[model samples]
Target: MDINAYSARLHRDLYAAGQLGGEDALVLAEKMANALDPSIRLVLLDAMVEAAGEITEGLAPGAVEVRLAGREVQFAVTPPAVAEPIQPGTAAPAVQPPAATGSEESEADGGTARLSLRLPERLKGRVEEAAGAAGLSVNAWLVRSIAQVLEAPTVQPPPAAPSTPSPTVKIVTGQHITGWVR
Candidate 1:
């Protein structure tokens, strides 16, 4: 089987599945052809071999070995040394801060950040309903709500006193008041 032909067919199939345009598919196919990474090629070959095995199962079963034209190379990789376990009563070493990178700075400067939070199902449903009612996306609604809460004043002035001076007045704690009467 011609590898180029197989690759081209794979590209078309992938483009169709992905719903990509003709020009995009052509570009992607060209990239794939140029790359020709061994792992990806092996994966395609493996799938084909598996399918062939299924087809030939009635004729011969048990095990199948695939032979490919390639030179074998071997290299020894030293395993990383394991750290000694901490003895009982010994304090663990402090963790050092990670070195700052360009990507981290870029992420901080208006770049999109992903936030994943686990909320109760009931709360999530309520938030989604509120968001729909407000004609805003859930993300937008949450952002606006958070901003409002942060911008609101923590304390408010006492409310204005009535014209008739009562001997004693109940001091409301939680309510937002305006003025303090002397």
Candidate 2:
């Protein structure tokens, strides 16, 4: 039941079968065992060992040997079976859609998108205080504020004259005139 020892043996077997090289097999085996669930680890390991046997069988006699779980295993390689050609009028297999999972169901019901924001500490504290006072979550308060602003009508100020005096305007008879008078 020593996982490290088992992993080492598997690595050696895989390397000997030419399926993997030294060091690579060790790293691969260690990673696979660690990443997979304990319940399925042994099953995956068994499949790997089986594949190694098949791979060793294809090699020249005495080229490679596979050992698994402290026992030597034999293998024989056979020619690949020929696949039948598809007919012109044949219909291809239909693909099925993936099943909906819990996360997908929750997303559909809530219609909510998660957001991660990086805000200044002061701003974040202010938002938290406002949300608490309003009896709403920070997310809800922010969404409501944004929606209100977006839905409100925008106002624009009337245009003003240019700040600089126009060069065309000049004094005529001691009074200002927009244009030259003769």
Candidate closest to the true structure, highest lDDT: 1
Q: For candidate 1, which ten residues in a row score worst on lDDT?
A: 72-81
Model 2, backbone clash pairs (residues 3+ apart or across chains), number: 0
- In the range 1-182, model 1's lDDT, one tens digit per residue, is 44556666766666565455577766776666557646557776667655643432322212222345452222212222235789999998776543232223334665534466889999999997996665444544565576566658887769986686555556668885445455
How does model 1 fare in lDDT? 0.53
Q: Summarize candidate 2's per-residue lDDT along 126-145 as a digit string, tens digits.
A: 99798556544454456556
Using TM-score, give the best candidate's number.
2
